[model samples]
Target: MINSRKTDHLEICAQKDVESGNPGFDCIELDARSNPGADFKAVDTSTKFLGKKFRFPLMFEAVSGGTRKAGEFNKSLASIAQEYGLGFGVGSQRAMIEDKSVADTFKVRDVAPDIFLVANIGAVQLNYGYGVEQCREAVESIEADALALHFNPLQEVFQPEGDTNFYDLTKKVNEVCRKLKVPVIAKGVGNGLNLADVEKLDVDAIDVGGVGGTSWAIIESGRSGNGCRLFDDFGVPTVECLLELGELGKPLIASGGVRSGVDAAKSIALGASLAGVALPLVKNYFSGGAKAVEKWLSQFMFEFKTSMFLTGSFKVEDLRGKVLL
Candidate 1:
C-alpha cells in the first residue's frame, strides 16, 4: 500500500519526536550585524529558480518515497545535490505511481544529473482525479523541473487513513496549472499558506509549509495513536507564513522550521525566493553518509555567507526587502 506508507513516513519521521513544538524559528530574527561594511568576499550565493540556474537558494525538502530505503535515500541525496550546488526533492511520488516496483524508490534524477529536480505529489493526488496525463506522468517520472503540490489538510484531517475528499481543490489546482509541463508548486504540509490562501492560487510558486516545521499533524497524530493535543500546537508560523506570502508578488518558498544559515538568511529577508530544508536534512541524510550530506550542507552554506556579509547583502537578489531587524 504505497510501499506501506513509504515505510510509514520513514518510521514516523525517524523514531518519533513528531516535530512541531513550534519550530517556526521564533518567527524571524536576524538583525544580523558584526561588520556591515559588507564584503565577506562579496557574498553571492546565486539564484534563479523555475527557469533554472541556481548555486544556492537552497531546497532539499521532500523526504523519501516508496522503499528500498527510499532508493538508498535518494542515492545519498543525489550525492549531496552534486556536491552542494543544491536543489533536490523526491518524497511523495505516490508510491512510485502506485507500484512500479517502487520505481527505484524514486530515481534521484538518475543520480543528480544537474540538480534542480523537484516532483513530489499529493494535493489529495489532484483530488483523486489524476489527469493532465497523470500529472504528466508524475513529471516524466522525475525529470522534474517543478511540481511540488503537497498541501496536507492538517495531515489529512488527523490521519487514520486520511483522504477526506477535498472537493474541487482550488479548481483541481487550477487544472494542474493549466495542463502542466513544468511549474506547479503549491505546498503546505506544516500548515502555513495564508494571505487568504495566497490570493486563491493559480500556482507557480509558494511553499510556506509553515508552522515551525515538522508537524504533519504531529506526524500523522503520532502514527495514528491519535492523542491530539491540537496536533501539538498547530500551524502558520514560519515568519507569519513569510509575512503573509510576502505581500503577494509570487515566487515564495521558506518552508517550515528551517534549520540554519541564519535560518536561511531569515528566509531571504522574509520574502524568500527559496529555502526549504527537511528535518535537518533528514538527520544529515541518516548520519554521515554522502560525506555527511556534504558536511551538513557546507554548514548551511557557511551560515548563508555569514548572513550575506552581515546583511550589507551581495546577491540572491540582494535578499529582497533586506531587513534583519
Candidate 2:
C-alpha cells in the first residue's frame, strides 16, 4: 500500500486532470508606482515560522513519503529547502507507524538537519486507533521542528480505505498539541478552510489548503474508476481561504494552488504568514530535477520581490495591508 499509494499520487499528479477550483491569485490586483521613493533593492522577503526564519515565505509543503522512492524525493526536496532557506514538510508517517521497517523513509534529518522540517499525520488516523505516542514517534523519527495534522475529509470519504471516524478528533488534536513538544499545524488537503473550522481547531497554526491546486478528489475518483469530476470545482480558492482563515488569528500557511511567487505575494498581502506549493513543485521536480526546482524557486523569489517592490512593499510585512490595486 505504501509504495502503491506513493506511486499512485505521483502518477495522478503527473498525468491526471486533477487541479480544480479557483486558487484566487488572479483576482487580486497589486497597486503600482505610488511609492516612488520606496527602495526596490531593499525589499526583504524573509519570514519567520515556528520561531525559525526562512529566506522566503515559501514552503515545499507535504508531498510524498513512506517508501524508498518517497525518501529519495524527500532528500531532494529537503536539499532544495536547505539551499533556499525555505521550510519543508515530509509526507504522512502513518506507514512508518504501522510498520517500523519504513520509519527510515521519513527520517530526513541527516539531509535537512537545520531546515524547518514538519512531521505529518492524518488527524483522522486518531479515530483509527492512532494516538499521541504515534505522533511523538513521527516527530522524533524526523527530528521535525513542527507537526502537521492533515484533515482531508473530502478525500477521505472518496477513498475506498477512508476512515470516516472523526469522533473526538478535536480532543485528540488538543492532546497532540499539548504533549507533542512542538507546534501543531491544522491543515486541510486541497479543500478550503473557514473561520468556524479554524476556531474549532486547537492548533497553533492553520494551513488553508484551499481548492484550485491539486484536487485529491479527482485523484481518488480516477483511482475508483467512477470519478467525482462534477465536484472537482469544489472548495474555496486559496486566496479566499487565506483571507477567511487569516482572520481567525492563527499563523497562516497559504497553500492549495499557489503556483508562483506572485501567488505567494498575494497570499501574504491578504495576511498569510507564508505560502506553500506542492503539486506544481512535484511536477516540476519530477520533470526537471533539482536544477529545475532551484530555477523555479529563484524565479518565484524574483517575481515576489518584483510584486512587493511594485506595490511599495519594502519588507514582507509591507505587503500585508496595502497590496491590492
Candidate 3:
C-alpha cells in the first residue's frame, strides 16, 4: 500500500497541475547597487547548515523514496547534491519502516557519501504509534546528517487514508529532538509554517514548506475519487513564512514554491539559511534525466550569483537586508 502510494505521488506531481498559490517572490525586488562590492567571478555562495558546508545555499528538498523508481531518483538526486555540494532530503521512510525489504530504495550513501542528507518522517506518525526509536532508524538507515519531522496537516486532511490525529504531536517531536543524535528540522508540506505552528518545536532548523509551489492538497485530491478544490490554494506563502519566523533566530529553509536561483537569492535575503526545490527538479528529471537536471541547476546557480552581484553582496551573508518589498 505504501509503495503504491509513493509511486502515485511521484506521477501525480510530475504530470498533474498540482501547483497552487504564489510564494510571494514577485512582491520582492533586489536592491541593485551601482557599485557591486565584489566582482561577479569572485562572488561567494557558500554557507553552512546543520554543521555542514554547502557550495550553494540550496537544498534538493524531499521528493521521492520507497520504491525501485524512487530509489533510482534518490541515487541520481543525491549524486547531484554531491556534485553541487547542496543538501538532499529523501521522502518519508515510513514505507521502509513498515517493510524493511524496501529500505534499499531510500539508501544513497554509495553515490552521495558526503552531502548533507536529511531523512524524513511524518510528524503525525507519532500519533499512529511511531516513536523515538523509529526516528533513530530513519536517520541511521540513510546515514542522514539531519532529520526532518514534516508536519502536513493540510495534505493529510485530504489523504484517503490520512492520519489526521496530529494532537500533541509537538510533544512527541520534542521528545524525538531530545533523544535523536542528529539535528532535527520541523518542516511543513505546502502550507508553510507560522510562528504559532513552530514555537514549541525544539528543532535545530525549520523548513517552511510554504505555499506558491506544489499543492499536496491538490495532489491528494487528484488521487481522491471526489475532486476537492476548496482548500487547494490554502496555507501561508513562502515569503510570509520567512517574515513570520525570522524573529525565532532558528535557521530557516525556504521551500514550497522555490523555482529559479533568483528566487533562492530572494529567500536568502529575506532571512532563509537555504532554499529548497522539488517539483521543478523532479519534472526536469522526468523529462530529461540527470543531464537536464544538472543543466537547470547550473543556470540556477548563475542566476543566484547574478542576484548577489547586482545587490553588491559579496557572500551569502551580504544578501541580508538587500531586498525591498
- Model 1: per-residue lDDT, tens digit, 1-325? 5677657777777666766656455545666566677658878888888877778898888888777877898878876776667788888887777777777767776668888888878887766757567777777877788888887777777877778787768877888888887898888867787778657878888888788767777676667778867656476787777777777778888888788888778788878888988877676666655677678788888988887877778887776666644
Q: Residues 210-279, candidate 2: write the lDDT tens digits.
A: 9999988889888877544777868778887777776677889999988888888888888888999898
RMSD of 3: 0.8
Cα lDDT tens digits, model 3, 233-291, are 79899999999999999999999899998899999999999999999888989889999
Better of 2 and 3 by lDDT: 3
In candidate 2 the C-alpha lDDT for residue 94 amounts to 85
lDDT assessment of candidate 1: 0.77
- Candidate 3 residues lying further than 4 Å off, grouped into runs, are none
Deviation of model 1 at 312, angstroms: 2.7
By summed lDDT, the worst window of 10 consecutive residues in model 3 runs over 224-233
What is the TM-score of each predicted model, taking all chains together? 0.34, 0.96, 0.99
Sorting all predicted structures by lDDT, with the top scorer first, yields 3, 2, 1
Instruction: Kindly give the number of clashing pairs for every candidate.
Output: 4, 1, 0
Clashing residue pairs in candidate 1 are 23-212, 24-212, 31-324, 212-257
